[model samples]
Target: MTPRIHGGGDHLGVARWDFSSNANGCGPCPLVLRAVQEADPSHYPDPSYAALRSALAGLHGVEPARVLLAASASECIQRLTAWRWRAGDRRFWTPTYAYGDYAHAAAAWGLVRVKEPGLAQLAWLCDPGSPLGQGESPDAVRTLLNQTPRTVVLDRAYTPLRLKGDSALSAEQTDRVWQLWSPNKALGLTGVRAAYALAPLGAQPDVQTLESLAASWPIGAHGEAMLRAWTQPEVQGWVAASRATLTQWTQALSDMLVGRGWAWAPSEAAHGCAKPPHALDATALRARGIKLRDAASFGLPGWWRLSAQRPEALTALDTALNGLALEVAR
Candidate 1:
């Protein structure tokens, strides 16, 4: 049976205090916003995306040939899985609780989910991982890399939003596996779908094959503008500055949850998980313009994952929690 793909931002209409999605709370960086707004709508972006790819490659200190752009991280996951399936890979493995799309894509492509990393033809590793926001061990990464006849992709979507701790992989270690990045989250532009991947140093042939499977002009003008702005020094500086604010917010939110009898889950990133003392009336919270992600979809039942948001949002959440507590008391 195929697993369901669940995400934080659903079509339930926008919430006034949306702590469900992990997008940077401090951004839509001003510089990036302006760039995207100014993008020409009359003409198509250069079909090759040469300049944009080169900029991203330069930022990561990789060759332009190693860059693979996608419409979004989800799209990239599906495309990569399809490519692997076509290449006769039928076994997949994920090191920890991950975004739902990885498992969904594998199931859609008829790939068997494997328990052992070494036995799978394809593997996924996310540093400062989703839902729980914990980094992987370097030893585990080395073990996966040493596994023969395997293709490993490291999802780096949250790397930019990490508030504390560091990645387990060194530059040398990371170069041995595919690195997938989605700048939209860091820039607070999740509405704009754009992502890119850096292939392993000698995986040019594999990268070329994946590119061949993609549709013509995979990214539109606005996405092109967003990706282009992501490589700028000023935009990166803004993101770095925003982390300080997120750190403070995360600490405040954790303290609030603990005070209200919720069990705070340890995390190093800007987002974390917490288990409520009792089952929550999610529908009630939604009506109050508040949203928290149910972590059950990420494999942790009875827990919710929340992104660090502004003080106003936190206050709203506190009020909602109080109301729920009163309801339970009555």
Candidate 2:
């Protein structure tokens, strides 16, 4: 735990607990950092966002008008709040990790907050987790959505960027799926928070209002440039490399966990969401200078989420975990 400098990414130093996220280090893309400083995508200094939206819209199979790019998914949560009341102490959330801030935003909106071992109206779950990279079941999701219609807002972010199985909310459907995807998280453009929403496409006023608000206040110039660069062929090459790297790291990490007599999450579901929650003791890990997020936050105390972000991090984790005695795995 360190002072998050508004956005200074020092969560990298967490030898044990990676609270920040597993964005799998973005490599030399002709798209970011000094590249932006060098060349520019300002073919139209006052460009038409249509091109950007069109690209993402086509990818998601949505109309350009349905596409609304925002600074970050957090902005989407705020926009969601504009439609839904923000406070009254009456609301709902389910077990989750790494929600940018949707539940907190809902609470801020003033409503009767309801949480528990089982109070899941609007289940805020993530398949194939944030930092851990596990996947979950669509049937499970459908069940949750069936439990409560027009209430749930699932996060289907990592499902796309990384190569994966069928996402519970990736199709051209899923009305309850209000997915917020960030290239920064999966594709590694953390600075450029250009993300899109994959909610239901329809004549809903709520969605239209959110879309209009986003268009009028789009993701800005820097984000637009980052998106353009990421969409470039050279940059996409980086994504492919990153995916391969992740696959390798994931296998190594899984092997290490198994060798240590712990269960490695299956890849069938998406990030490790299908696997049951488990964790190592923080007090013992603290002895190793490994501070972990208590899984209790996501309903599994001290069991920090771990994903094979890259080869190096996975190696480090395997080494660290291997050094531990069998007692710690429990």
Candidate 3:
């Protein structure tokens, strides 16, 4: 198996000006933080997650039976892949650039990677996709959804973090594919580790099978609290309000980088990719308490993925780049 590459909080410890992970810069929402902190760890979450599932379903206006719980988004990816593979799915498709876990899980199941969506029994889609924050044309999404006997999972992890633009799939179209959501990123509490998926209409059997495959109590106390808090109206409001601040910060970061000769890849989401005028020395940047995600793993070797951060963090990044430039000049 290929080694997984990721950003944020590495062995070197968290960077002071980390532009790697795409967690909401304006959060750890106060509501979520309080919920997670006050969570009673003395007991395990209900093994079936009955209350949590119902709450999430109510939020999306779906039946509670359509909600499937997972320990995290990655867990859902792997579980969904395994569930389909067991049912004789031997081919999988992924976007040209996508979260590594999608492809990673498929590969582990010995599935062939099909270049075209029509040829695969299992497919993954991430809207406002990772690394680039771009999505397939709505027509393309419709085409994928229209295919029969294909297990299509649409990862909606970044939907809440979108600074602008709407999803490529409509509500009815979205209901046709499995919708995987991990709100910890939106709540800015990624460490909490909880996620759930809304199964396609009439996919209760698939949901049950996936649940049976899961370990009991996949979510613990804190994760349960965070997920429950995620369904609250106030928490949703907090996420909506953060997007405005994120937009301004994203624009500022783009302007600063472009002025310094970096070429920004237009993105509608909070994170984006850019290529430096010259090669980037990641090691040198980290030395100055800065970290950026190299886009090489996402098939863009010359670019880096950066998230919108607070102004102070942006200033620190600016200072770090200047230092690197001075050293290069010397």
Candidate 4:
């Protein structure tokens, strides 16, 4: 069976105002863009990726040996599941509504879904999780850790984009789980796919297993440049500044939606789900070059996940909703 497609972006060509994907609205960071453009594609990157790995490790204050790079977060998900299956894992669990790939990868590798976290061999957790943007509860994390699952992976793709709240896990607690990092979303360079994970401390054997399963040169020149840019202080500073802008935009968009009778789901991230006052024709909005993610796929029906965009884009969305309201009244 084919893997299911997940998330939203400019997949159907490009929308004039796209709120489907939760990428940083204020990026691609200028520094990251420059680095990608200057990256030389003529030569292959050092297969060992020593310098790049060290840079990332230094940024996170983790040992370079614990870092496992992949083509993207989705690829890492599949590869990790594959390795776990080979090691006799036969059940997977996701504590909350998750990215589709989590289930897809598990099923593809012959793992069945288990509702009870303690019974599962592999568990997936996303903080400031997608479609909803809420952080995982600390008590819940503690419970999961106490359960002692065979493997647990925490997807931190949205952590950097979180507009509010801290992670539920303490640093020491974080070291006990696989922390996956996908810098492209945070940098607004999603087109250049590259992601890395910091394996749990003392999981060197599992790290080695993952390394063997990986195809050499999993990341390309542009991806390497993007990941490299992610390690720079100035680039992170840019990301920090962008959050301020995103905060303002998020509030403005939420207010507009609320005023129009849409019910908003509270979120700590720059993106969130909101229910329209009435049903909306998604295709009609697409025709006008606007896109909003339907949340049914993420298990939230009657809602759409909208990313905060610039004021002009918000105005365009407001106008589109007004049109829909008018047609419904007619």
Q: What Cα-based lDDT does every candidate model obtain? A: 0.90, 0.54, 0.90, 0.88
lDDT of 2: 0.54
Q: Which candidate do you rate higher for lDDT, 3 or 4?
A: 3
Clashing pairs in 1: none
Which tens-of-lDDT digit does each residue in 75-163 have in candidate 1? 99999999999999999998668888899899999999988787889999999899899998677777787848688999999999988
Give per-model TM-scores: 0.97, 0.70, 0.98, 0.96
Off by over 4 Å in 2: 1-20, 25-48, 86-90, 95-100, 112-125, 144-152, 161-164, 169-172, 204-208, 211-218, 233-237, 261-263, 267-294, 318-330
- For candidate 3, report its TM-score: 0.98
| Model 2: how far residue 260 lies from native, Å | 3.1
lDDT string for model 2 (208-244, tens) is 6666555454666667766666566666667776676
Candidate 4: C-alpha RMSD to true structure equals 1.5
Ranking by lDDT: 3, 1, 4, 2
Which segments of model 1 are wrong by more than 4 Å?
Answer: 1-4
lDDT of candidate 3 over 188-298, digit per residue (tens): 888889999999999998888999999999999999999899999999999999999999999999999999999999998999999999999999999999999999998
**Candidate 2: deviation at residue 159, Å?**
1.3
Model 2 TM-score (2 dp)? 0.70
- Please tell me which model should have the higher TM-score, number 2 or number 4: 4
TM-score of candidate 4 on Cα atoms, chains taken together? 0.96
